[model samples]
Target chain A: MKNIYVAFCCEYKKVSHSKMLWITIVLFTFIPMMMGLMIYVVRHPEISAKMGLIAAKASLFGNADWPAFFGILHQSVATIGLIGYGFVAAWIFGREHSERTMKDLIALPISRSYIVTAKFLVAIVWCLFLSVILIAVGLMMGKWVGISGWSHEVFVHGMTKYFVTSFMTLLLITPVAFFAGYGRGIIVPIGFVIITLILSQFIAIAGFGAFFPWAIPGLNTVPEGTEGMQLFPISYVILVLTCLAGYLGTLAWWRFADHHS
Target chain B: MEEIITTEKLSKQYKDVLAVSDLSLHVRKGEIYGFLGLNGAGKTTTIRMLLGMINATSGSAHINGMKVHAGNTNLWKDIGYLVEVPYAYSELTVRENLEIVRRLRFLDDKHVVDAIIDRLNLTQYAHRKAKNLSLGNAQRLGLAKAMIHNPQILILDEPSNGLDPAGIYEIRELLTSLSKDQGVTVFISSHILGEVSRFATRIGIIHEGKLIKEINSEHLEQLCKKRLRVKTKNNILAREVLLQNNLICEEIHDNMFELESESAIANPDEIATLLVNKGVPPTMLNVVEEDLESYFLRTIGIKGGAK
Candidate 1:
């Protein structure tokens, strides 16, 4: 237990000191800021018309109210959060291989399993921090834009849904970690993320979003009364099972596989 | 003396290549065991298997009488190893890299990091990021990481690589002191026979994934062949005179005779007198011993760098 704690602290320090962490923070902040800009343009159509193509595109978010603005934040977390969290996972797990530092960790007094687990913990914490910061920035930008129809009930509901969607997206990062280990670098895992994102969109469009683990998170962003967005309990089960498999597979690969790198 | 490192029939077969084949050896406490092999001769493979970085296809390795397995983290507590080229977190400073290693190794004393830095002469580069360090300093950081916890057994692969002559000498002195004063058992692998022969108490030469020769450093001198080389104005006459005098001699090169006879090498003065009397006065006559490089290549069944 103590060794795992030490490994966790070391892993945290590694991630915290990396420039990638700051890059992710900057990237996540931009997504919400872009949503806020769109909300602002929708609130004033006369100005949007006088502006160029970007203003015309921003008017697509109809009726720039508090609910519509929250919808933007929710959907962004479901989709953008998926890619962002996947990037974090890939960087955390794959940097050791890419940098050829994996050998330094293998022949240590601490078990490889502990090191792997600590990495996952750090990734989780990093992704969660990004999620929280994105939401906070999104809320502040919404207020700055003066979106109407704000209420205590609506705020609680929007925040609850946003947290759940982010949680679901974060759960999918384990498979990304596994790919990072299997590929022995960030390229393959990041490729896996892109493929999964593309496939999720196609599968969700085919009316089988709940069946695919990657599509389920996006489906959760659909409004309560939306048609064809209903998810079965088995969808949640599959996501949980996928997460478990990835978690265990990564640990086994670290502990049992021949670490030639 | 207690045996600190022992491998029995250790073998590793990778796809179509036999990296290490049925190798067995023992390293005793306070002994500097130099493992010598040419490039692609399974030196790195053996070190990796010993460190449990790779699973052996057959056989096992034991460190401090404990079997080495993937999950046997306890065995690593007493063993400090550097396999092949050492790489660290390039973005982290030299001190930060050592701190990470210190935590992973479970060292309680925080000051050990500073001590190791001072010992390795890395105090100047303590705050310098590893990526900015020169090759020699990077090599020093690797050695500091391995020696931070101060384990009883040290298994290093090419530890002196990428160091200047002065740095190599300093490392050699450090390793010698560790083994002598602290009783640390060292198993170092290198392709440089002269460097290893200078300090290793026992030397093992590996060829084609097999242990070809094992010699004590004390006996290495006697094993290397010595001969008398003679150059004369009339090489043909000199050869003839030596043959007539019952001395075995061969014309190695133009006007030069190589005499491997024990008597010829021991008493070159006698041959010179005989040559002068025969009117083939020796211009040059000297006894030379075969260098370690040639002896290594010869033992591995390669004739002077050619198969």
Candidate 2:
């Protein structure tokens, strides 16, 4: 309980940092809203399922023909979340080095790994908070657009895929958060994540997206009936583990940061 | 009491450059230890290694007797830090920034930060965004961030780097009180020797990745430093006078000789008068001391011995 409180406080500090506040809020709050907007745009009656929802879902939910509510949630955790988190976290991590804050934070009496874990937790919480807001907004939009309760199975499958797949993706992306957690510089982790994402797609064309970190979209691949199985129990765990890795990494940095500071 | 931090032969290598060489350092519990060096003397690098931000090529360090590692990070609960510049969310309000740190350090009692705010006199400015604060205020906020957790140890890097004189004095006083009253062990660094000397009880100078000098404030005080800038009619004459007097004049410019008084009995200003009496019109004759700037220059030999 004490450690958790400590870690919680550790992460909470970042939320208040005036420098990265807007970025944090945007990535954590507004991006989901944007995801909803895009879904709302693509699902207009004018674009009615010309291909019976492949393009429809792609246009709106990226792959899920979800109802207004679930569609927004699906898109956020997957595509939109990736783009938003990528730049934000990357810069946040890089700022430590660029701004040279690593010297101070690491020398605190706290455990180094705990700092890393705390940050990872902060990012996850940010993601979760955004996901919930997006879900609420999407549901409201559904009611507004009068597409409420549309039982589109493909939508359920796709949303579930993203929800569940985000975990595995998180597991795969743990190293990235780890790198950025301490990289403090833009070049190393940003370049690595971008190249990895692009290569994941190419390799998948060679049938390796199954193993590629970019395969997040693929894992949101409905395993027929299991649906969004990963979200309810698994991917969220990945989020936890990802957060854990970050926390641990931060702790490690703290332990030895004295020299660097 | 056990040593709070001890590094045995710690060194950091950045590809080709050895930022910190094999260095052994010791800081006793509750001591205010200052790491001093010129720019790029590996001060930042040394701090990074102590915090475990970067790996050491070879060596080990312990914090409160525990070897630096993941499981040991919880020990950070007892530490506070303010790096070169505070890394904060620029958009968040000061209150918000404190909140994030409070939550991240997992501190539930707001009193810790409230106390720090009161002490730092940051409450009136608390509502403003941290980015909106000026450099000195930012430094205050950074100190607040580090101390908010009420840790027993503070590792601060150049806490007074960018601040006005009053601000610098306030921070120094605060640090002094933290050590004397609260019993917090502080590890701080500054390139400016005078600044570090204001609050540091002990000082260690690192030059070119090596721990060249580690002296207590008492010893540093007895070093008998005197700064004399004497202007002679001819640069050659000034050089001859300074060399003959066995004074290692640091900067010799046209018609001017600048150096530290090499002995206790020697009066540099008196030497200037003698030169004037000997027929050189005294353009500028001043004996300035009471700081570590020149001693630092001579000791560290700034920037690989040339500058």
Candidate 3:
């Protein structure tokens, strides 16, 4: 666990990632605010006009449910956290491939699984920094927008869904990270993700395309009239499955995969 | 002596390519076994399999008789690994890295950790960040980190990869002396054969992902024969005599001839006498033991790949 934390904090202190987190929050929060403010200033829209737009765009954007917020959160995490996780984890294992430090680490009496677990947990922790900032932005944006019908039901259901989704989403993204770590190349994971995304369209023809790790961020789209009742979709079940799958993927790879480092 | 580590026909394959094929290795208690191989020879992969980092395609491996698995192995508690170059949290202090290892290994004794730090001469640099330390100092910290838990089996893969000559010597001295002093069985995988020549009692050669041979250090010495080199003023006469006597003579250069002979029997005086009998005892005569460099080249059959 201490080893886990040490590995986790690797990205927090690195200047490049620190700058990325700051830049994400600053840009994401301010860009939305600027866009919202522009509508008010230029159009001087009537309340009816805004309400009409919400009513019309309900399928697209209006409900603004926890799933939607978390969906966007998943995208942010996937785009930013996925890259960081894969890159850092790549560096973590790749350092051994690129240099001789792997010998220094493996000769220890410690188990290699523990080392991999520590790195996986560390990547999770570092990725969480991005989520923490995003959640803060979400809180601030909710208050500023005066979108308060805040209920314990919404908070509990949404927060659970958010956390579980993040954990499960990490499970999905991390397998690629395992490849990145073992491959120890800068472009390996990046190329993997791009190819996966491109080919995913053909793969998604199946009903459980929702179960595919790439589509996890957008799993929860609340249909009309069930807004108040907290019913997690069957797709949400895929989160635990995916998390289990991710852990097993890492274990299997570690068990069978060659360490180029 | 107890066998601390053993591998039974352990093999690892990558796709169509086999990286480690049918390796069976035995490491005795309190012995330093140097695993010799060049780059791309699968030394690290073998260690990783033993450490349970990768699963074997076939066969089995055990540390302290416990079978290697992906996770949840008690063997890790008994082993310490230094993979390649030493690394820790670059931003964290040296003490922090050592503390993490100690804590992860679950040693309650702060005194033990501190004692290791003191012995490693890292007390002064305890507060300094790992990345800030020199390569040698970083290696010292890595060694300290591995030793902090006091594991019985120490598996180091290329530990001297980035160290200077002095640092390499220190590490060699440290590992060689570590077993007798601390009762630790050390398995050191290195491409640097000479460093471990005097340092390891048993040796294993990995060539092209195959465990080409496993031999006792003494047998390795035998295979690495000591040649009797004689340079006479009249090389043609000496060559003619050696050929007529059915002695194996290799022409090293224009004037020098190398013969396969027992150094104990064929001393410089003996060689000089032999040359005198041939009426050409007019130059250098020396008996030298076969070194690891020559032995490795001859065994692997790849020329100019000297270390």
**Which candidate comes out best when scored by lDDT?**
1
Per DockQ, the best of the predicted structures is 1
Write candidate 3's Cα lDDT for B135-215 as tens digits: 888878877877777778898888886678877887788877778898789999988678887778888889988888777
Which portions of model 2 miss their true places by more than 4 Å? A5-176, A182-213, A219-261, B1-4, B29-31, B103-108, B149-152, B181-184, B225-291, B302-307
Error of 3 at B98 (Å): 2.6
Candidate 2 C-alpha lDDT tens digits along B253-296: 55566766555125655676656666665677777664577778
The stretch of ten residues in a row with the least summed lDDT in candidate 1 chain B is B248-257
**Worst window of 10 by summed lDDT in candidate 2 chain B:** B260-269
Error of 2 at A251 (Å): 9.3
DockQ for every prediction shown: 0.77, 0.35, 0.21
Supply the DockQ value of model 2.
Answer: 0.35
RMSD of 1: 1.9
Candidate 1's TM-score: 0.96
lDDT against the true structure, each candidate: 0.91, 0.66, 0.66
TM-score of chain A of 3: 0.62
TM-scores of chain A in all candidate models: 0.97, 0.66, 0.62
